[model samples]
Target chain A: AQSVAQPEDQVNVAEGNPLTVKCTYSVSGNPYLFWYVQYPNRGLQFLLKYITGDNLVKGSYGFEAEFNKSQTSFHLKKPSALVSDSALYFCAVRAYDSNYQLIWGAGTKLIIKP
Target chain B: NAGVTQTPKFRILKIGQSMTLQCTQDMNHNYMYWYRQDPGMGLKLIYYSVGAGITDKGEVPNGYNVSRSTTEDFPLRLELAAPSQTSVYFCASSDRGSNQPQHFGDGTRLSIL
Candidate 1:
């Protein structure tokens, strides 16, 4: 079965500090991984996706993720954390052969303290 | 471009009442989906449509129905409201292809009492 896991339910970081949100997946074959961010009372916004390119993928709002095939991980990272960056983050994965079905992680709440 | 729009941004319903949540996309996307989000959890897919007149069940399709009559409209129907159904519903659309990002609506907040 294809599944995604976000080990941390919540992560705290001080403003201006580097932040990392961990994610891992278990799939049968090569996986299409994605990250999304949701603000309060709003729908989720696409952050980045790793399809079949460079392992390090850059996305909106200065966010990025590194896809590691060996470890089956795709962790979201940012050089500096901002108060506005605090939100809910989700990791999703889909096996290349799956019929457009995405397996989503529980989600991680990121808190950036100023 | 009004990517994806959902109606009744907020709604309250009494038990046994029925209602439909409206969703439409102007992008002419071939794929549309309905998902429910609880207070502190990830989204659960309820239904999805690949194109007009074609709809299928998703991860959690119980207690709900959906219809895709046209390329742009996909509405979710609840036959009888229940307290457990109280959740924020999101509608999303994606073009015809893999790896394409889905566009989402602001979401509809529904509370069943």
Candidate 2:
């Protein structure tokens, strides 16, 4: 089975400052990772995915995540935060050999302060 | 393109009652999924369909039933509503390949009393 862990329950950062939300995973085989964001009372929107590409993957809203094989981590990062970026972020993973069923994290609430 | 659409944005059901959450996608994608989101638990897949008339259980499929009669419609049924079933249900659709990203609907908020 595959599992994802978002170590932080909440992260606060000032607007225009660099921000990071940590995520790590454990899977038996090659990992297919994804990041999603959810606004209030809305469905989750896909941010980015890491399958078999460069170490860094970029997605919507100027967000990016770095996939580190050695650390078993795929942390979401933004060069500068915006208040509109505040939302619930989730990290999900699926094992390559599995039936393509994804395992999601508990979610991390990101707040961009003005 | 409306991507995915879910009906009855908000619903309240009493314990032991039953209800069905409707989901439809216009993308003509081959993969569709149902997931429930709790306060902090993120999203847990309740069921998924690879194509029309084919369905499979997901991570948390207990007390839930789903059907994929057509390529665009996948509805989830709750046999007996329980407090534990109260959560925001999201319907998503993706292309056939594993490399494609899933598109999600706004979600339906269901509360069990």
Candidate 3:
């Protein structure tokens, strides 16, 4: 079976500061990774995905994630943080075993302080 | 377009009660999925359908059922609701290929007492 993990339950960042939410994965075949954000009582919004391209994948809202095959990680990053950036971040991976269903991490709560 | 839509934005059910959560998509995507989100635990897939009339179990498929009678709708049925089943439910759809990303609905908040 494949799985994803987010080590940090919560991340605190100040406005204008660079923020990073870490994600790691364990899969049998090539990993299809994705990032999503969720606001209060809202559904998830897709951020970006890493299929088989450049390790550094840029996404919406100035967010990006670097896929490190050696590290078995795909960490979400942003050049600067804003108060509105505070939300729940999720990292998902689709393993070869289950090409259609995604294996998700526990989730990381990102709080950006103004 | 309303990419994905889930009805009954919020619902409260008593233990042993039954309810069906409705989901509809306008994109005509070949793939549809149901997932439940809980605190600390990320979204877990409950069921998925590749197309109309075809359904399969997902990561956490217990105490729930789903059907894809038409290409645009996939409804999840919960028979005998339990506290454990109380969570935010999401419906999503994607194109036929694995490379396509899934579009999600606003979600339905279900609380079981």
Candidate 4:
């Protein structure tokens, strides 16, 4: 079964500090990973995706994610966090056998304290 | 470009009432999906359509129905509202396939009492 896990329910980071939201996956074959961010009362915005490219993928709003194939992980990262970066983060992997279905992670709340 | 649009941003429904959550995408996406996000939980897919007149059930589709009559419109129908159905509903669309990033609407907040 293909599944995505966001181990941490919440992550706290101070403003201007580096932040990381961990995500790991279990899949049968090479996976397509994606990251999305959701602000309060808003829909998710696409951050970045790893189809078949460099290990480090850059996305919107100065956010980036590293796809570690060996670790089966795709962790969202930012060199310098801001107060406005506080939001919910989700990780997903495309189902190997399904048409357009994605296995989504439970989500991680990122809190950036100023 | 109005990427994806969902109607009735917020709603409250009584038990046994039925309602339709409308979704439309101007991107002419080939794939459309309906997902419900409950508090503290990840999204659960209710239905999806690959194209016009091609709808299929997803992970949790017991109490809901969906129709894709055209390339741009995919609406989710709740036959009988239930307390358990209270959730934030998100409608998304992708141009090519799962590998492509999905575009989402603002989402509809529905509460069933």
* Each candidate's fnat: 0.54, 0.85, 0.71, 0.76
Off by more than 4 A, model 4: none
Kindly give the stretch of ten consecutive residues in candidate 1 chain B with the minimal lDDT sum.
Answer: B95-104
Tell me the tens digit of each residue's lDDT in model 2 across B32-96.
Answer: 99999888787889999999999999989999999999999999999999999999999999998
Pairs in steric clash, model 1: none
Please list the C-alpha lDDT of all candidates, in the order they appear: 0.93, 0.93, 0.93, 0.93
Best-to-worst ranking by DockQ: 2, 4, 3, 1
Q: Model 3: which docking level applies?
A: medium
Off by over 4 Å in 3: none
DockQ of predicted model 1: 0.72
Q: Residue A66 error for model 2, in Å?
A: 0.6
After TM-score superposition, the amount by which residue A46's alpha carbon in candidate 3 deviates from its true location, in angstroms, is 0.5
Per candidate, the number of residue pairs that clash is 0, 0, 0, 0
* TM-score of each model, in listed order: 0.97, 0.97, 0.97, 0.98
Against the hidden true structure, what lDDT does model 3 obtain?
0.93
